[model samples]
Target chain A: MLESIMHWWEKKQYRIAPYLFISPFYILFAIFMVYPICFGIYLSLHEWSGIGEMAYVGLENYLNLFKDGDFYLAFSNTLWYMGASLIVNLVFSLILAVLLNSALVKCKKLFRTIYFIPIVTSVVAAAIVFTLFYDRDYGLFNLLFVAMGGKPLDWLGDTSLSKFAVIGLIAWRWVGFNMVYFLAGLQSIPKSLYEAALVDGANSLQCFLKITIPLLRPVILFVMVTTLIGSIQIFDEPYVLTGGGPADSSMSVVIYLFRTGMEYLNLGYAAAIGFVLFGMTFVLSWIQLNLMGAFERKE
Target chain B: MKRTLLLILVALMIMVVVGSSGAGAQEEVTISMWTHDNLYVEFFTRRGEEWAALHPEYKMNFKFTQIPYDQLWPKILTTLAAGTGVPDLIGIEISAFSRFMKGDIAEQALVDLTPLIGEEKEKFLRWEPYMHNGKIYGVESALCPVVFYYRKTAFDEVGVSTPMETWEEFTQAGSKLKEKDRYIAAIESSGDTPHHFLALYYQQDGAIFNSKGELMAEDDPRAIQALQFLQEGVREGILWPTSSYFDAPHFAALKEGRVVGNYMADWWSVYYQKPQLPEQAGEWRIQLLPAWEEGGRRSSTAGGTGFAITKYSKNPELVFDFLHYTYMTKENQIKRFLELQYFPTMIEAITDPQITEFSDPYYGDQKVGKVFSEAALQIPVQWQSPYWSEAIQILYKEAITPVVADKKTPEQGLKDAISKIRALMK
Candidate 1:
């Protein structure tokens, strides 16, 4: 039997060994990722409370999700943060990345490490610190304002300002991480391109607009699309700080999904919310990619 | 390859078979419980440690775990939904209980506890929140009846006396104290419900959902009146705006005497004040909640927790027996109070001379237990639906907040909240 097994193994190893080597990941992915996603899609079509029989409701959950005012509110709030944060964060990170990649900049490693430190810090801890920073009476901003003879403003309490308060913390934690990606993109560009541009009649600004910008197009598009998706599905900062308050103005799509699925225990509806988010991210990313002509270039 | 695969499969099967078949009959019954309350775990775990070895019919191996309050709901929900990994026992908070009991999930996820509660049901102080459609699915270890907690120092300084009988008197006292820059109790226009809205609205003949299981907050005249009264107090500059009572800033304000009045449960004195504002000892006192009308009910239920046996539990009868042994008995209830400061839910425990005679230095030597016992027994029973959380979210954000922020009238806000909630239901 051992002789026969060894012979069979020797004959079949080339054909089946690679699949056997990678089988564990496939098995795990099927169970954890693919199955739940498929089950979630199935759940989106039904009315379920995470227990009992899943009542088939066809498109009812999705239909209701569309008409629900809170759904729209959460969507808009998420978009607001995404739009504002994306613009400021991208511009800031690009500047930092370019400066770090510059020839004159010394201690590039130290600067890179310092900028990336917050990205590695725990999100919850950072959010807690930001919460204290936004405290109405004792917060840093209000304390400074008070010292300057201005009244202390309610940062997390006011509806108009709370979203920004949450957004600021989000940007603070994420900008460094985004800059790392830009840094990689900056480093990847051949020095010859810049040297060639400089050698021509082009000045620094001309070289930048003509050479650096176009070469970094793929990376910029990559950063922009991912940032848009991540910011839209934001949950931790607002959840930990404002708890999607003072009037649900800071609630994002993921927060709504959490509230519906977990707080309300409406798993089916929450599943619908999730699918809607997926659809939204997909469509928006597609639109963004097309707008940027990301796919137009071979690179 | 086939022989090697077959050998591996056979070995795995044998291992699986050996692993699960180790337990025999007449073995110890182990029940695991999950909760967000730390003190409860400590008390129960100590009780189990001492008493577990004494059980003859079956040994007790009780495991109590404390999960974080916010994450507990999602953890419980996901486990219950997946129909696996559910603990033998779980505690659901009062404001959150309705969320679990909202739909068929209650029936499917919970072991029907009616048979266990039996004729002793009347002994429980407040349980309507743990029931759904005439079925009792859970039993609480503590009763958190809402009462008016005021700072004696502030009220004495303002020359306002205790035991205000009606809303008129309460508001008048608040307005009178406004002269000293100290207002009445602060009402929240944000954050979780059952903090301000639930306690006040349920003080009278008012409910978010009517007896017919209909959402009536927007149209229920009593609810509308309650919201209007709360908004008016804030508008009148009598009720201080400290946001939610649970927030850090509000806790600071409480210590600073910015808002010296609070609408809180009996547990707040021990669970919150003793821990968070210990320096304010000997200056706070508990009184009956002000009546909405003359001679009206002065008590309502706030945040508390009740343990429910999950349907996933294998030995529910055993789990139930252990639960009853630890919680339902009078001796243990009193012990629970002595150890954890949980306000006893059982009538006998509450009425015990040992309990009612308990005085608190924080309340200036007042018998805190007497207030809890009196108010606890008087808390009104109101039916609730699982959709209460969703409705409450809208009620707080769209309805109640707009009124308090002076952006909308109570009527308009309520109307909008109702419409918005109705849209969510669809």
Candidate 2:
């Protein structure tokens, strides 16, 4: 029996070795990601309170979600955040990346570290600081506005401006993150391309428009897709800052889902919301990629 | 031969160590608890030591974990679902209590504490929130009777005497304060929860749900009246429209004397006011909440927490004994009051001299405890419903904000909120 086992092991070691080496990641992915996705689908079809027996309710949760006014509000708010963050973060990060990539810039490392600090800062600590800064009465923003003879604005209280308040926080934390990606993309572009454009008597704007942007398409698409995903699922900034308040004006889809599942104990409804969010994210991302010509022939 | 002898000697040593540890484990009863508040952990730890000392035969090993408020409930629920890693005991906040009682989980996940509490149930000031289907699930932590906290200096400046007695008088005092560019109280216009509204509503016998857990906010005329009172107060600029309470803007407003009055539970004085506004010592005073009618209910319960034993506990009886000795006993209840300023739910403890006669210098050397204890007996019950969290969210969004913003009348706003909540219930 020992000889037979040894013979089998010798025969299969080469084939099994590779699987053993890569099995950890696949095992973890199955347990965490795949299992959750499957379970979420099953949960969406049931009525559960997270602790009790799940009663299968078929498509009721989804049907209810379709008519849910709060869900629509949260959906619209999340789309607004996605569009705003994508534009604000991408534009600011691209500008910073271009400036930092320029030879005219000095102390590049120091500037990079300074700009990156907010990304590394604790969201809770940053939120506390921002709360003080956004205070309607004594906030720094209002204080400065008042000094400049402008009316004091309720950064977080007003329903119209609460979304912008959250957007500002999102921009502050994420601009640096996207900037790093753009910086890498800029560095990867050969210096010869810019030199050739310069030799051809193209102005800096022309060179940037024709050469730099075209070369950075992949990175921009990557950033746009990520920013879209991140903004749609935003929970921390709005949660810690405005708490999706002033009448759910700043409520994000993830915050709504969290409130449904954790706070209200509507696990089935929350799971339905989650799947809807996933579907929305997938459709948006696909459309975004298609618009960026990511699926076109690469040759 | 020497190697074999060495192995035997090592095995003997391992056996001794393992045997000793096994004996120790057999003697010790490990009890684990989870709470969101560190203060509770300290209270429990102190009580645990005393309990252990009193019961020397049963060696107790207590483990207390303090989780963040937002994360703790999810953790507890997940553990309860998995039927593993659940603590022997849990501290359930009053707001989250409804979530736990929804569906069959209340019975499956928690021990029926009714048997343990038995006749002692009558001794608690409030048990409605922790009770479900005629069975108690948790031990009440506080009476949480709401009181009106005001700045004496601000009131004196406006010539408003103590105990405004009626909401009409309170509004008049607010108008007086408004002339000096100050507001009497801060009304939260965009608060995440409808605490201000709920407190006043409950004071007038308004409840979101009836005792039978039926939706009744729309039918409750007092709820509309309470909401209109807030809207009118804000419209007249007599009440400051704060973004939220216990925040930077609210504290800044308080410090600058832009707002003076605050209505909250007894714990607010010690937990938030004294600690947050220590410089305003001796300037604050407490009184029963102003009644809607001249002699109506002056106090309403706002917030509370309860300790409960989990069904998964290996020794639930032991846990109950510990809770009874600490929370149910009058002596420890008074101790909790003196140490933590968490007004006790124990009826006997509410009238104890140590609790009622205690004076706080922060509130102008007033017998703060006495005022709260007096109100404790009159605190209106806050019934729990599965739709509570959703209802509060809807109440703030569809009702309070639109009403306060003058986009809708109180009647219209509340009607909309009720219809929305009812739709959700379907």
- lDDT, candidates in the order shown: 0.82, 0.89
Could you give the interface RMSD of each candidate, to one decimal?
1.8, 1.2
lDDT of 1: 0.82
lDDT by residue for model 1 over B311-350, one digit each (tens)? 8899998778778878888988888876776888898998
**Candidate 1 C-alpha lDDT tens digits along A133-208:** 8878657999999999999987887888889898788788877888899899888989898888888878999988
Task: Name the TM-score of candidate 2.
Answer: 0.95
Residue-level lDDT of model 2, residues B1-426, one tens digit each, is: 999999999999999999988776547799999998888899999999998898877778999999998999899988988889999999998888888777857788899998888887887778788888878888877778999999999999878887789999999999999999999998788775678899999998888988888897875789889889989999999888877677878887888999999888878877878878999999999999988887798898788898899999999998999989989999999998888888988888899898889998888899988998989988888888877888888998998887887888999999999998998777
Model 1 chain B: weakest 10-residue lDDT segment is B19-28
Native contact fraction (fnat) of model 2: 0.83
| Ten contiguous residues minimizing lDDT sum, candidate 2 chain B | B20-29
**Candidate 2 on A1-299: residue-level lDDT in tens?**
99999999999999999999999999999999999999999999999998767899999999999888889999999999998999998999999999999999999989888889999999989998998898888899999999999999988888899999998899899999899999999999999998988998999999999999999999999999999999889999999998999899999999999999999888999999999999999999999999999899968
Each candidate's TM vs. the true structure? 0.90, 0.95
Task: Give model 2's DockQ, 2 decimals.
Answer: 0.73
